[model samples]
Target: HLERLRALAREVGLEAPLYTCTAWGGAAVPAEGFLPMHAAYPFTPWEPDPSFEPVPSREFLFRSPQQPAADWWQAGAFRYPIERYPYAYCELGAGIQMTYLHRPLVPPECTQALAVVALGSGCNWLGYYMYHGGSNPPGRRGFLNEFTVPRLSYDFQAPLGEYGQLHASYHRLRLIHLFLAEFGDRLAPLPVVLPPGASTLKPQVTNVLRYAARAHQDQGFLFLSVYQDHAETADLEGIALEVLLPQERLRLPHEGSLRLLRGMSAILPVGLELGDGLRLRYATAQPLTVLHARERRCVVFFAPDGLQPEFALARQGCRALTVQGGSSAEEGETLYAWPLPGLGTRLEATGLSGRGVELLVLSQEQALRCWKVRLAGTEYLLLTESEGAAWVDAGEERLTVCWQGEAQLDLLSYPRLPSSLPATGLLEDRGTAGVFWRYRLQCPPWKARWSLEQPEPQVVRLRLAAEALEGVRDLFLRVDCVADVGQAFLDGHLVADYFGSDLPWIIGLKRFAQPGRELELILRFTPLQANAPVLRYFTRERLPLPASDGTLPVTVRAVQLVPEYGIELPWQE
Candidate 1:
């Protein structure tokens, strides 16, 4: 894959660089065929001391081409001191660290001091494994050791803690981002050449390109905080508002709101200040970037890089029209238009009346699209091949023409005495559409319904040897049934009656027969109903079924039977 990619890049005049391999902490790497030398630290059952000093435990060290060192390397990927083995280690065995930027914690004092000394020392680009930490996605609740997952607040102790509304790290990272944006290309190609005087900040030169966006070079940084807030845009001074990265700051224009990100994109919020017009721009690309905002004063700018006049807004009574000359226009007072070929236009409006209004797109004749007001008083319109669409007022109650052409009806039955029936039958060949036995049943007296489909022919017989005739409330046999396309019978008596239909059932007592002394069932099936269903049969031992109060525990045993297939051809015995 790498060779093919390199060849493709060379053919297309592209630069291809390979990243280095980093070790994951495990005794046995599952997919790869390898054995273990030892286990890692912390998880190696070592006791934590009161002093909080570094104590050596069992942990894997690197097998390098060079000599070894003393302690673990916290900053650089390579060049760290190895205690027991020969090479430098990259990742630790999962210890908690924190960085808070972008936005601060509600209470900033908690993570006021500790900055990311590790990644900051050697790496050009740095990120707190979690700066403004938050909860993991919800999993199974109320299980033992549920808190094995971290708490909701991921606030690791860092320079800017998790709780402040705005953290100090926010400004720090933003400044770094701005600086890096100005000089990222030089930084990426240039090796990290550490200068003297910064002993605490270790600088080891390596070809490590850390964070990346898809552009030949990505020159911006994104920082996330703990609070659930909308994208906010700030006036970045000293840079041309147009040239200084089209995608920038955004804030929740409304109170208690935030935007949900479907995927990665260059669309950020332009925070709307009260009484101020907010203009935001985004470069149009494939998988069109969508901005969902609540306030109307906020407008989105679709400014493709190297393209002109890229801005749009959803306005009332206005239509986004794409003309034949590859131009786009918003139909307002002056008809502000832009040139577009394949791109169609959309106009969205909210807070309209229920009677609905019509907007005319006049070419040679009136080609208007009429829209009906929704339940929330908003109107929706979809462009079609037809130059005209009509909208009729959907009265107080919303009128919806559901295209459910026919009613799928199934008639069920209710039975008094409950009995289990089998489902299955023998046919000429082992093909489907043959008659299989299933018991459809309903209990009108118990207000309960049930059925057995494709059931086998079996009886749950209870023989009273005359001496074992004890505790008999009422001796009556009940077969629950359903009439799918024909009449269902219990003991040769019709329990469920149906005509020219296909449905499932739970009918135990038919008009033709009721459960009395003997229990025998003959089910009449039609071609319209499903194949005979499987049966579940059990004797109603303590009969009269709830005796008088009509509420008794009925026990039924399950019997499952599957068909056995025939032998295959061309076999050598």
Candidate 2:
């Protein structure tokens, strides 16, 4: 089959630089010069085996196989020599989707931690499966999804949702991507050096720290993973790691011991080059990304929830300068700095050559709002926490900022200031009470009322008077339900479908429903089995299902008409 595919590609006038095959799933032999690829899904909760190993294909690093079909390692069974091809991972599961048997929720922090661990484990290429979610179209045979999969919705709770909504994971993973984008070339050929007893450490052992480094020429990144898969982890205290550099062996923190919070991971710098004139001795806080300007280069770093933001600098004739937003203390030749709590702060210093090096320290919450964008052939970093819609046009040199529900924008870092501001008046905040239109269901014909709850899986016909949707431009029906699946219909045609998760189901009604006329609406629900064995095994404490009498307990939460507001900002090069 591999020969036939290669032949077909040649016949079709297609040439490829690299040939690869999936090395997992009962491995088969691949053609010579073809690289074998495997997926790393450490956070998957429904795996049959959860043990950690040390092999490159199964564990994390590449090792040459002794013989073909060897039972000693999982990848050895494929009869492929590890030295013949480069080891890479093409599919790392970023997050999991809902299934009939298992519904696993991947936290934002866990996603970031697993990515760091994969890199530390000697993974060369980092790729993600289903970074964004999508909806499934109707199938001719049946629903087209797996028997255990959701009927319509395929929102996998990934970094990007099915509706292009940005989750917290998006921002968290962006930090890692930005770092890789800047420093990946220097880290590509480095070899992984694991600390002793890392491979033999059991999942239950929380005292032993897991640390690894990818070093070339004595300068490398120290990867630390305090998170364990599917196990409760304790906080690691009094943590100190010894890193060997070209000139000397340095102990991190340079003062007191540090703590590693449970279920958190970080990649710290060792002998990192800050610029031509200075180098970073060591740092406890993780390096986020680097920002380059015309005059100077800035390195951004952040501390975890519990750890202190402390780092040392080693340079010739480098003196510490007073920073406006943070405190600094000088000890001997090394200078240490710390940022203010809750507020994002910038610390600056001047080297002997008069070159500037700035460090921007931010809390985790403040970092989530940071976005990197390109406008008018220039890059800009924006910090805004607006719930309303916002966009930027590079050609027009304009920024449309939205104001909704106490939304604010702080220009943390930008290339230059805007030339003009919007002349529009401020939009009044009417609160949730003013935006949400609530209704209840009555008996018989399902007439809408002002009170009482309605049963699920039943069609409730609703008529919207013109006054009810007076100034509404875009209307949405929010369904608060605890069901397996839901389908919303209008006038007899299915309009939208939703899969049950922690997020509520929102159906857009702007294009379908007429505002002034009476429209018929139908909602269909599918209840989950109350006695599923997998549900009992997985979620023994919380089932996430509401009590019901053979029918799903779904209710109409609200009819929200999101108001659109925009403010223009004039910009120049």
Candidate 3:
């Protein structure tokens, strides 16, 4: 079978390396005859430590690699080629799919910090298990999900919801992705460098800051993080730190100390080569993405609040240098500093043979919304604000935005976006800063209205007239209820399921809506059990589902159906 597949790939002129993902417990699964690029997906179910501080525990997990540093199993179980393959992960868990017994609610900060830590810990290629989640297919006997999970909702708590709704984790991971897309070429070769006590540090250590560096030829990035979800952590004020790289040691800021606030994270560049004459000594901010104009590259950086961002530059054959929207301090190496709220601030350097790169600074709030999208034949860094993007289909000229309650669309694009560019929705001109054009997206109102019906004791139904939804693009059905287990069915066919952890369900009704037919949805919700033992689960499964226990409650508070808007930016227009 492998030979046939290889031959077919060769016939099609595909030359990509072939690899297989397997588990450690499986036998003959790694397949000795296959190539040595075999790897396994690693998952860490984070739990609150009763003995140690949460900050240090979170830091340790991020600093450690997915694979074992030295594994005897690699020598016995399979012939793994460690040197040939870069330290990578089959799945590095951007977010976890929740189970009924163990429901761990993950926050955006967890993933954002995890991504930076993963990259700094020597993971070159980061692959998430379920980047986009969906419904599990129906099996021969029952639903395809395991006994521990829900029958229908595989998205449980993934980064992207089952109906393509983008969550907070999605945007956080997108920030890391945008950075990797911009600096991955240079970051791929640098080896991770840790501090002297990094390996020996325990989970109780909160006095020190968590940091790591990756350097090559004295040029790389320093990864810093201060966020953790498991435990409550306070802000660190006036924290003195030193980055002990393999070659040399240097004190941070090169001026005063820094205050590492709670939930703060960044990636600072070190001696990074820009063009031929420009070299970045260091920066206190995080690198987001780069935008290219006709002649120059606008290198972007995100300066978190509370700390002033400074950039140190190395001069090579330069007679003069200048900066705009920022101030320069003449020192051993010329350092340029930008104040707080440095939103869309532009800086230019004319020295070093005129080969200097431009810098675009963004505040931490704006940086979260910073995303890369191909618009009108060019890629631009678009700030989505609190309003986010679900998917951008450049080929179909569609941009889908998902909102739960009230949909507020705010977008900012670099290089001045025109008003007439969007195919759908109104782009209100909110003005511009520097070369950026700010626009607020406005779409048509909802057309469809719904009525509720209580058919059975624990079951309810929603009816939407097909006539009202005739021209509607998409309708998102948000169910706000106090039920434990929720299930949504269309035409008596089960399509969605949810446990108690899903506070309000965001189900996309457009997919199941038939053409010229009235939309009918059947829903069933059960009361949450206070203490359902796992040992008695099998015996309880055979019995009928209890509607309520009087002590526990179940109520369908409200059901809302909102129309989703999609706008398209042309690729060739």
Per-candidate clashes, comma-separated: 76, 1, 0
Question: Candidate 2: lDDT of 355?
Answer: 80
In the range 256-289, model 2's lDDT, one tens digit per residue, is 7888888777788876777746767777777767
Q: Each model's C-alpha lDDT?
A: 0.24, 0.60, 0.64
Clashing pairs in 2: 56-61
TM-score against truth, every candidate: 0.21, 0.78, 0.82
lDDT of 3 by residue, 1-573 (tens): 665666697799986665454432322433343433223222233333212222324333334332333332333443354455565555556667655554555666766776777777777877666678888888888767866678878774567888877777887787778888889998988877776667654445555677878877678898877765555567888865575546666666776888888776668888776664776777887788887666676788888666667777764444445666667766654655553445547766555556667778788777776766665555677766543243433454544443333345667778766444643344667787555787776655655567888877578888988765553456778777655578888878888887755346778887787768888889888875535532122223333344455323556667777666655544343
In model 1, the Cα lDDT at residue 237 comes to: 19
Model 2: per-residue Cα lDDT at residue 162: 61
Question: Which candidate comes out best when scored by TM-score?
Answer: 3
- Give residue 522's error in model 1 in angstroms: 64
Per-residue lDDT tens digits for candidate 1, residues 10-94, read: 7888864522223333222222221112212222112222122233221211112122123233323232222322222233222
Q: Give the TM-score of candidate 1.
A: 0.21
**Residue runs of model 1 more than 4 Å from their true location after superposition:** 1-47, 50-122, 137-151, 157-165, 194-573
